[model samples]
Target: MTSEEPGDSSVVRRDRFSGGPARGFLSSLAADERIFEADLAVDRAHVVMLAERGIVDGETAGAILAALDDVEAAGHGALPDGEDVHEAVESAVIARVGPDGGRMHTARSRNDEVAACIRYRLREDALSVVEATLALREALAETAAAHVETTMPGYTHLQPAQPTTVAHHLLSYEAAVARDTARLLDAYGRINRSPLGAAAFAGTPFDVDRERTAELLGFEGVLGNSMDASSARDFLAETLSALATHAVTLSGLAEDLVVFSNRGYVDLSDDYSSTSSIMPQKKNPDTLELVRACAGDAVGDLAALLTTLKGLPRAYNRDLQRAHRHAFDAADVVGEATAVAAGAVRTATWNEGALAAAAGEGFSTATGVADLLAMAGVPFRTAHEIVAAAAPDVEDGDDPATVAAKLDAAAEGVLGENLRTHVNRDDLEAALDPARSAESRDSAGGPASPAVAAQLDAAADRIDADAEALTAGRDALAAAADRLETEVDRRV
Candidate 1:
């Protein structure tokens, strides 16, 4: 305020407008920290491209690049106030290199520059989410491999449906998370494209090499349409949608663990648990409860973001500035939640005996019994009816002799034949054993130990492939950084 320059106008405007109170509301500088480094990199690439195209002299490009290095070292906090990071960065450069610094903005506009910066920063965030999800899948697969035979009750509608192993349950989640990871990676493909050189939606008059800038910045390619390049925020929306879906998966896992802990079928380690303020015996899974609630926040963010963009006209609006934070916030929320879920799953301990005991409760083995009768030449519906009749007399796995007697009597009414006419009594007794019932399920992806082993092998192969893909992505980003620095060194 003390300087000769008017606070209301920027370096580019040079005091054309008067100061007002609404400057605070209009300025996005205070909340632009996430894109600070990205803005620097994009600015650097654009400057180099301008020099190579003879839009600016080589010496001037070197000086501007040198000034940018100082600005970066001084850090974002030292930036002079402006409407956004792009202006703040330009102002800093002009201050360092004097009049020659103005050459850096020759063929660019804030529209294209901000779009490029958002993509540069968001690609990293998207990759981080992918890495966290892959780690969670690895944890699930590892835990499941160790418990291929650990029997548990699988439920539908919160009631015991059948006997299944812990491996089967955990691997089911692994499959769900794998699909989420795929969505994130697919979104990353779209997010990494360069939007630089578009120059205010219509593109630059100066013969700028869009592909050269993209190469320097690690973008897979340039966004072909200048209007779409600068105006499109669909990639942002897609990323948030992917994260919200993953958060739903995370909530389901949290719900299952919470219910399992409640039923004494699992115990979360102390690292992931909490005690009540007043109740002495309370060991609550508070971390998981919070994780379950994170899904709502993610969904809310997605809704707000989409609502903000519902009817805006194309090609870079100021509203875009307000929209990015929703995507950024959702990505952060889901990323942290994914890591917490992975840790909780890895550290948890399953109660085998309790799970097994609960597996056979409430005639959970009724399906297995019905299957046995159907295999014995009785119509499948007749078998189902006979098993339902026997269910009221005794639990399927509790009293084998009582269940057998009831089944034969029920058969007399339903089929007019004894149960032993088809299946031997030994086979009848074996079918009533929950553990034996699980063992006999040798179908692909069944609860049997052998089937679970096949699933483990498939899961390992997938985790390895995803880990390699993530590593390749990180390597590409690192290589781009190195290439940009080397080229900058040549210019400086």
Candidate 2:
């Protein structure tokens, strides 16, 4: 390889052009700065592995490792101009230790090195996302626990369908976010594998201990196939998919809160809400509206990533460099959105009287009455017809006695008997009461208070277990870094 003079361009361009406007078009330095620390760590691990495999002399490995330490101290911005951080770091290492520094690239190509660096940084990024999700879940669980018996209307097609508690509604979102956390943790399993020794699109000729480097980097294991290792980016797509799903869950929660605020069913904290510039009476859910928009952003990021990976052939491509920007953006947007949603839920106040007043509107307990008549041996369809016939008389302002008289007349017309023959007035009134209607649904996973209590307890347990898992992962990475640093010290 021909060496550029000291004052010449340090970039290793395959084309004839050394420096020009094209370099700016191809440069990834701005994005590459995100993974500079990971790049140095990969160098340290790779150098230690090389010396252990007898591929480089101890003195040369020590010199390269020490120079890498200097380059790290100088930071990514201090490096010479090049195509990317990998080239810039390599150029810095070579400048520090002369020709022997080139030995750092002996067993690995930029393809596998860049891949490893991405995985190294993304594992932590994914973990941070999971942590944010857990915080949101905890916030939701606490809010649900506080409102386990606060009766409200549950809707389908945005119309009242049944009576439910705020706890039941909030727990539903907690369930979805729990699944989102599981998807991310599952993706982490594959994302944490090492691709260090694949060397380019093929295995290196030198005998390299891929497992050793993987262990030193806290990866669960090495990616077995060299070509697949160099080309695979499915893990990134999988993570963004999980994030997009999570963002959708957040969007639903935000939409519901916005609707509740509109209906006077809930009041958001002033911190999360915004006032109109001219209309002094306006207090808008601007934070939630932005969170709802973030769902679209996450979905777009996932689409962009899948589209980028869709047509690329096996082995590394320049196109793969653009992939990280999508992953980083999706994770960041979703993470912040998750936190904002948690804050909104934690600080919002539910209007119990208003929610209860609306809960029984639209004859929301009609299903409960039908269920009660069916339990007394009336055919369900017959009972449904009897209630449907009397619904017009049971209007918004009618007294219970008048409503019952109308229902009795309807029942006699439908069944040729008074409605009291099979059920008493007390039973009928209990069935019609929205609070009793919600409380009557005591089956497992129902919107009843006891069911919601069980769900909230289960959510607490899941949050604790997931938090511990994240902590264990971080501890393992710290231990690996400690081991790597100790080994480097011995080699130096």
Candidate 3:
């Protein structure tokens, strides 16, 4: 070991190489603000566990914990300059109680401690994302519930392809977001496991009770292997991946809203829109455009995290320090984007006339026409060909009279028979009408009023289930916090 730097009070016990350029290079105090409270909680749990295990006396453990309370009150900004939050906190504790404060680090390593702190903090972040996702789904369902039969254009490759109700359009996005919520909640299960007692990547001889600390910290359980507990950052990667995917979902939702806003089919609230600096007539979907662009940042953050973790050896490394900003940044941005999306959906207005008119343009009901022909004894492909050929001559695809006349003419040319030979004019007219066409395709999960109403009910059930789960997770953590405080009081 090298010489100890006794003059600098900020430096913890390990002082072989201090005050070098590498010291500043290796510091993580700035990036550690998010985990400060987490570190304090982990310290309290570990100190309580150490006293219980007879590794330290109740007097020292209580003193260290009390000093920790002082350190926490001082806040991360007031922390002494150290290599990281862990060292700075330990140093602060030592300042309060002298060498006895050093006992708080007993039977634990920065390796396991940092892991535990990250998991503790990240579990809350994951749950927050879940909450945001459910909120967005609720907004979608509310808007959809109100417009179950409001006919709108559905598109393929951004070109109008069919007439669907506004409810169907919004519910599709809700379904995607519900899945994103599940992914985040599932990841939370993995993140809430404790890594605390895995001292420096190996078990210590002090008989440390990992599960006791885990329980105090609200972890579902302790990691089974000390080495794995100390080294694993896979939880971080999985969480970033989930957040990035949800960002992509939000991007798609944002894209649709941006496009609809441009088409005059939708108009977002002024709170979610911005006016152009020079163009007096312009109301830009700036929030949505940023949300759409956030996908790239989310993807980049995930990529950076995964790349940093690549090809590392089994234990903790200095490189791991660089990985957390990615997850933290992604979590914060994705949650904000999700909430903004929820607000935008809840407050936006839809143009019923524009949506209805656009819903019928571009031969949108031709598929329903073909389906009608098929039902009336014509081969489906033959019906499709008839409609495809007739579309060019019809002056207005939405006009049933004109579409029927063109289809009859095209059928005579294609099969030497009028479409009237297969289906009656009344049936043809219903098939060509956009409103009737939307209602006609009333299979399960379809765009019809009854189908969308069924979907709304289902969406309500899912939101309830997810909200209950969210509340359970939060309640469990709050209870754990109470238990931890009780333990601290007994020792103090």
In lDDT terms, which candidate is top?
Answer: 2
lDDT of 2: 0.90
TM-score of 1: 0.97
In terms of lDDT, which candidate is stronger, 2 or 3? 2
Compared with the true structure, the alpha-carbon lDDT of candidate 3 equals 0.89
TM-score of each: 0.97, 0.96, 0.97
Q: Best TM-score goes to which candidate?
A: 3
Clashing pairs in 2: none
Candidate 1, residues 338-418: lDDT per residue as tens digits? 999999999999999999888888778889889998898778998999888767877535578887888899888877889
- Write the residue-wise lDDT of candidate 3 on 284-367 in tens digits: 999999999889999999999999999999898889988888998999999999999999999999999998888888888889
lDDT of candidate 2 at residue 49, scale 0 to 100 = 93
Worst 10 residues of 3 by lDDT: 1-10
Instruction: Give me the runs in candidate 1 sitting further than 4 Å from their true place.
Output: 1-8, 12-18
In candidate 1, position 91 carries an lDDT of: 82
| Order of models, best lDDT first | 2, 3, 1
